[model samples]
Target chain A: MTGLMRRWLAHAIFALAAFATPLLLSGNRYFAFIAGITFFSVLWATGMNLLYGYTGLMPLMFGGIAGISAYVTIGLSANGWSFWLAMLVGSVAASLVGIVLGLPALRLRGFYFTLCSLVIQTVITLAFVYFVNLTNGDVGISHIPLPELPGGRQLAGTAYELVLATIAVIGVVVLTVIVESSFGRRLTAIREDDGLAETLGINVTRQKLAAFFVASLFASVGGALYAPYVGFISPRSFDVLLSLNIWVMVAFGGRGTIWGPVIGAVILAPVPFVLQDYYTIKDVVYGLLIIGVVVLLPGGIVGGVKRKGRADAPAAVAKQAAPVR
Target chain B: MSDTTLIILLSTITTGLMLGLIFSLVAVGVTIIYGSIWMPNAANGQFFLLAALFAWSTSVSWGLQPALAALLVIGSSVPLSYALEILLVRRFYDVPNRNISYFVLTLGITQILSGIFSITYGVWSDQFQLPPLVPGVTMLGPFPIANNRLAAMLIAAVLLAILFALLRFHRYGRALRAVFQNRDAAALRGVNVRGIYRMSFVLGNAVIFAGGVLFACAYSFDLTIAWTMAITAFAIMIIGGPGSVLGALVIGIVFGLTQAVASIFASPTIAAFAYLGAMLIILLFRPSGLFAR
Candidate 1:
C-alpha cells in the first residue's frame, strides 16, 4: 500500500540523516562526540520503547543491564579476547540477566512491577560496587582501548562515530521490522491486557520474556559500544538515573511510537553536554520537563498529536469510564 | 566471654536497636501513606533527606538546639505536606492506576530536590554531621554508645509507641483502618475518605521527617544517604507487606539487625546486597509480602 511505502520512505530519510550526522559533523570533534552520544541515547531510548511503550512494562533496571554488558565486554577484552567477540558475548549475557531480572513482571503489574524493577536496579548497582575486583569499586574503568580494525588501526574519532551511527540505524531498522511484525502485535495485545491476551491463546509469558531479551539486546549493544566510545565504565555510569533518562526520552517523545523516541533522543540527548557549564540546573530542568510532560502531555509529543486527531477513540473513552478498582 | 567479643556483641545490639527503631518509624510512615492512598512515594527518601538537611542547617548553622531543630522540622512537614497535597497529590486521588502516576510525579520531585541539593548543600560539603543533642557517651558493659544515639533511639521508640496507640485507639485511626480495609465500605459508613487520605499523607510524611532528623542526630550523613535509605525503607515495606504498620516494625528491626550484624563480617556494601537479595526473593515468592492481611 502507499502507506507502507510512505513508512519506508520516512525510514529511509531517517537512515540517511542518521548516517549523515557524524560525517557532516566530523570536522568538529566536539560536535561529532555529541552526535555519537546521541546515537547511543537513540539506541537506548528505542530499546526502552519496546518494553515501556509497546509492552507497558517499564524496566527501571535497563541501565543496569547495559552496565552488565559493558563490564563483561571490558573484562573479556582485557583478557585478550577480540573486542567484537567480547561484545557479542557480553550483549547475550546481559540480555540473559535482563530476562532473570524481568521474572517479577510475570507476577507484578504496572506500579508493582516498576517498584520491583527499581529494587532490582538498586541491587545490581550494589553488586557492582561490592565486587570491587570487577568494577574497580566505583573508581570505574577508564581509558578503554578502542576496537581494532582489520588494518590494525584503532577505530577512533569520526570512524567510531560512523560505526555508532550504523549500529543506531540498524537498531532502528530492527525495531521497525519488529514493530510491524506479528510479535509486535502480540506484545501490544499483552500490553493492553495480558490476562485477556492469555485467554485469547497468546503465550503471554513466552512473549514477555522474548520482548525482554530483544529489548535488553538493544540496551546491551549500546552499553558495549558506550564503554569504548567514552572510554569509561563506572557504576554511576549506568545507574537508575541512566535508566530513568532513557525512559524519559521514550515517554517524552511518545511511547508506543517508533519515530517518537528517536525524536526525543535527538532533542534531549545533547542537553547535558550543551549545559555542561550550568550543570547545577540541568537536573532541575530535566525534572521540570518530566513533570510538565506528565501533567500537560501524558501521551507525549507524538501520542498527543495522534490522540487529538482521534479524540473520540474508544480506548480513551474506556479509560475515562473505568472506575477505581 | 572475652572482652573483645563482649564489646562487639554489645555494639552490634546497640547499633541494631538504634537503626531498627528509626527504620521502623520510616517504614511505618511509608506503609501508612501507601495503605491509605495508593501513592508509593518515590520521593520518600528525598523527604527524609530534606528533614535531615533542614535539621543540620538549624542545629549546626543557625545555632538552634538539635532537639528544637528536630521539632521545627517535624512541625514544618505539616505545612509542606498540605502544600504538596493541594498542588499535586489530590489531583491523582481519583485517577485509576494513580500509583503509577504518583510514582512518576514523586520521581520528578526527587529529581528537582536532588538537583537543588547538589547546588546548595552539595557545594558546601560532601558529608554533613550534626552536633550531638546530648554530649556524653554511655557505657553498657564493654561497649560505649553515644548519649545522642541513645536519645534518638529512645525518641524513636516513644514515637513508634505513640503511632501504634493512635492507630489502635484514636478516632482518625479507626477511620483510616476502615478506609484501608474497604474504601467503598468506609465511604458507605460515613467515613470521610478524602479527609483520612489527607491526614494520613501529612502524618506519614511527618514520621519520615522525624526519622531523618533522628538519623542526622545519631550519625553523619551525605547526599547518597537519600537513595540508600530509600531502598532500605522500601525493602522493609515490601518485605513487611505494604500498608501493614506492624509488619514494618518487625521487619524493620530484622533488617537493621541484619545490616548491623552483617557489617561486622563483611563490608557495608555486602550487607546491602544481602538485604536486597532477600527482598528480591521475597518479591518472587510472595509478592504480597509476609504480613499482608
Candidate 2:
C-alpha cells in the first residue's frame, strides 16, 4: 500500500477500534468506565514512559501529581469556576509543581530521584489528609461536576466514555508530536548521558525539567478528567497504589513506544474485572504479577520482542540512541 | 504548673521517644537493605506487622512468654526473609529499572501482606503488653518516666548497640559492609556477594521483627499499622538520608519529638501534617538529607 493510504487506513482502524469499545462492553457502565480509565491510564503511563522510558527518569510520584490535580480541580470547581477552566488550572498547577520538584530532583540519578518521588508522594498524601477543611479529611471531595460537551450533553454515564476516549486520542496525538520533536531529541540525549549532553551544548537541566513538565501535564489532565468521570475525588484514589498501577501498565506494555502503554492497558486493565470474584486474592495476584514482570521480563512483552528483533541488526548502522535517550 | 499540662508534656516526650525508637528500628532495617542491595523495600513495614502477628498469635495460643515469642518470631523472620530474597528480590538486581521496580515490587507485597493479615487477623484492634519490665514510674522531681517507656528505650538502646557492634566490629558485618560499599569490589575480594545479600535481607527482617515486637507492645496493631509505621519511618529515613543508621536514629527521635510537640500544641491531625511538612522542607532545602553520606 502507498504511505498515504496506510496512514489513512491506520487512522480509520484506530477510530473503529475506539468506537467498537462501547459496543463490545455494552450495558455495563462499570466496564465502560473501566475502559475509559484504561485509556486514561494509558495516557498516564505514556507520560511516565516519556520520563522513565524515553528520558530514563523513573519518577514514582506520578500518582501524587494526578491526585493533586484532582484535588485542585475539585477545589476550584467547589469555588464556582467552570469545570473546563478548573481542570485547565489544575493541570497547569500540577505541571508547575512537577517542574519545581523536578528542578531539584533532576540532580539525582536513577534510584535516588525515584526515592525523591516516593517522598513527594508521601508528603502530598499527608497534605491531603491534614488539610481537612479543604480535602474533607478522608471523606474526600465528592459530587464533582462532570464535563459538559456541546448541545447540553453532560459528560457522565455513557457520555463520559465518549469524552474520555476523545481526550485520550488527542493526548496520544500530542504525545506523539512531542516524542518526535527536537525538544524530545534533547531529552533523549540527556537521558543517554547527561554529562555528554552537557558537553555537547544540550541544556540537560532544561530538558529534564521540560520532561517533568510534560509528564506532569498528562498526569494532571488525566486526574482532572478522572474526578468528574468517577463523580468523586478522594486522596485514597490516588496513592502509591495508583502510581504503581500506572507504572505496571507502562512496564507491561513496553516503554518508550506510544502504542505500548495503550496495549498494556488493554491487556491488564480488565484483569480485576475478570477476577472480581476472587476479590481477596486479587491483590496477591497483582503483587505476584508486578514482581514477575520486574524480575522475569524487564523489557516488557513488546519491548522484549523488539529487542529480539534488533539482536541481529548491524550495531554500526543501527541507532546508538538509548531507549530513554 | 497544672497537673493536666504537666501530664500532657510528660506523655508527649515519653511517647515521642518510644515512637522514635520504633521508627529507628524500622528505618535501620530499610537503610541496611538499601545499603547492601540498592533496593528500598517498602514491604519492611508489612513484614514487621506479619512478624508481630506471628509473635502475638503464638504467644496467645501456646502461652509462650512475650520475650520468648519475640525471639521465636524474629528467628522465623530471618529464614522467611532469606527465602523471599532468593525467590523474589535477587532477580531485580540486574533489572534496568532499579529502585522504582523494587518500590513497586514491595508495594505489591505490601498489599498482599496487609490483605492476608487483615483476612486472617480480622482487621480489628489487637494490643500486646509486657508485665512491668522496668517496674514503677520513676519521678525525677516533676517529670515522671513510665516503666514501660523506660524499658522500651533501654531495649532499643541495647539492640542498637549490638547492631552497631556487629556492623562495626564483627567479621560478618565487614563482609556485609564490603558488599555494600561496592559489590563488584567485594565480589572480586572473595566476599560472597550473593550470600551477603541474602544475609542482609535476613538481618533487615530481623531488625524489623524486633521493631514489630516492640511496636505491638507500645501501640495497637491492625492492618493499617504497617502503613502508619511505614510512612513515619520513611519520613525519618528521608530526613536523615537513606544509608545512615545513625541518621535514622537521630532523625527518628527528632521527628518523634516534633510530632509529639505538634500534638500537644495543636491537634493530632496537624501533628501528622507537621511531620510531613518537616520532611518536605528537608527534601526541598536539603535533598541529600541531613546526614545522607
Candidate 3:
C-alpha cells in the first residue's frame, strides 16, 4: 500500500472513533457537550501547532483572535443573525484582522515579533472593552442565539454534540491535508531559517501572515463553538489567561505533529471538569503540569513517547514518507 | 485648548513624568536581561510583583520599616532569581530555538507566580502604603502633586544615573558590557561570561524588585498587576530602545504622560491603548529598539 493510502486509512479510523465517542457514551447530552468542547479544544490546539510549531511564531496570540470572533458572533446574533451566518462572519473577520495585524508584525523578527504580538493581543482584547458601542464595553452582549438546523430547531444536547463533533472531524481532516500540503513544507523551511528561506526566494512575510490568518480562523472557530456552547459571550471570556491556556494546550500536547494538539486538548479540557470540587487547585495543577511538561518533555508527550523529543520527530516522519515531497 | 485644559495637561504631564520614572525602574531590569542574555524575560513583571510583596511582607508582617524591607528584598531577591535561573532556565541554553523556549519558560514561571500568589494570598488587591516615606503634596506652579511621587521620581533618577555610571565605569558593568557585546570575545578575554549571565539575571530581578516596591507604594496591587506592569514596562522599553537607560527614562515619562492625557479624553483602558498604539508604530521604524544599547 502507498504511504498516502495508509495515512488516510489511519485518519479514517481516528475520525470514526472520535465520532463514535458521543454514541459510545450512549448519546448522553452532558457527555456530548464535554466531548464537543474537547473537540473544539482540538481545533484550537491545531491552530497553535500551525502557527508556533510549524511556523515558529512566538508569543502566539490566541485570545485576541478568539475575542475578535466572539464579539463579532455576539454582535451579529444581537442583530438577529443566524448562528451559522454569525459564525462565518466572525471567523472571516478574525482572519482579516489576523492578516492585517500579521503583515507589519511579521516584519518584527525574533523577540520583537513576540513582544509586538503580545501588545497586539493586549490592545485587541482591550479594544473590545474600549469600543463600548460595539462590544457593549464589559457588560457584553448576552443571550446570544445558537445556530438552527434545517428543521428550524435550535442546536442542543446530542444533536449539537453530534453536529460539532462531525464538524470537528471535518476540521481535523482539512487540517491534516494542510499539514501534508506544499504550504506546510514551506512553513517548515521558514521555521528552520527565515533568512535562509528568504535567500531561497520564499516570500517569508506572506507565508507568516498566511499562517497567522489560518490560526486566527481556527481561534474564531473555537470562539464560535464556545459562545453557543456556553450561551454567553464576554470580554472576560477572552482574557490573557485564556490565551495562555490555549498556549499550554498546544505546548503540552506537542507541536509540529497532527495528533499532538488533539491529544493535548483531550487531556487538558477535562481537568477543570474532573476537578470541579477543587476549583482553586485547577490552575495550580495546570501550571505545574505545563512547566513539568515543557521542562522534561519539551517535544511534548507524543514527541517524548516517540523518542524524538523535538521537531526532529516531524523530520523523522518526513524521512519515512512526505506527502508534500 | 482652554486655560483649565492647559493646567490639566501640565498636571498630567508632571504625573506621567513621576510614573514614568517608576516604569523605567521596571523596564531597566527587563532591558538589562534582554541585552545581556538575548532572552526577553517575560517574568520580570512577576519578579517585581513578588519583590513588592516581599517588601510588604517584611514591612507589614514582620514589623520592619519599608526602607528596611527594601534592603531585605535586595538581599534575598538576588539569590532567589539566581536559583530559579540555575534550576529551571539553565536547561534551555543548548536547545534549538531557545528564544521561544525561554519565552514559554518565563510564561510558565509567570503562571507559577500567579498560582503561588493566589494560593498564598487569595488573589486579592489591597492598598499598599509604604508608610508615607514622603508625606503631603508639593505644588508645581499651581498644581498640587503628591510628594511621594516626587520622592519616587527622585529615587528613580538617582538609580538610573547610578546604573549608567556603573555600566560606563564600574569594572563589573564593563565586564557585563563586554559579555553582552560579544560573549565569545568576552570569554576569550577571561570575562567570566557565565558568571556575568548569573549576575545580570540576579540584577534584573533586583531592579524589578525595586520597581515593584516603588509601584506598590504608589498604587495598590493584585495578581494581575504583573501583567499590566510587564506590558507597560515592555512598551516603554521598546519605545526608549533596548539597553538605553536614558531612552527608558525619557520614554517612560512619555508613556505616563500619554496615558494621563488619554485618560482626559478616554477611559483608563483606552488611555493604555494610546501608548501601545504608539509603541506599535515606533516598532515599525525600530524593530531592534528605538535606540542602540
Candidate 1 residues B1-293, lDDT tens each?
99999999989988998899989999999999999998888888999999999999998899998889999999999999999999888888888888898888888999999999988897534789999999999888868888999999999999999999999899999999999999999999999999999999999999999999999999898998888788888889889998899999999999889889988888788878777887888887887789998
Per-candidate TM vs. native?
A: 0.95, 0.90, 0.91
Candidate 2 deviant stretches above 4 angstroms: A4-12, A24-26, A311-325, B1-6, B92-97, B124-149, B187-190, B268-271, B274-288
Kindly list the per-residue Cα lDDT of model 1 for residues A83-180, writing each as its tens digit.
99999999999999989888899998998899889888988888888789988977999999999888899999989998998898888889989988
For candidate 1, list the clashing residue pairs, or say none: none
Off by over 4 Å in 3: A1-5, A26-30, A199-201, A308-325, B1-14, B94-96, B123-125, B134-147
Q: TM-score-based ranking, best first?
A: 1, 3, 2
Chain B TM-score for the candidates in order: 0.97, 0.89, 0.89
The residue-by-residue lDDT of candidate 3 on A1-325, one tens digit each, is 7987887986788788877887777556666677877877777777878887788775456878888888887778778888788889999998888788777556776657776777888887788787889988779767766778778888776667776677667767877887778888888899888899999988988888888888888888778778878777777788767777777777787777887877888899877788888877776777677678778877776666666433456667657653231
Q: Give the B-chain TM-score of model 2.
A: 0.89
Candidate 2 residue A24 Cα shift, in angstroms, is: 4.4
Give the DockQ (C-alpha) for candidate 3: 0.52
lDDT of 2 by residue, A88-112 (tens): 9999999999898786555677766
Residue A214 lDDT (model 2): 89
Clashes of 2: 2
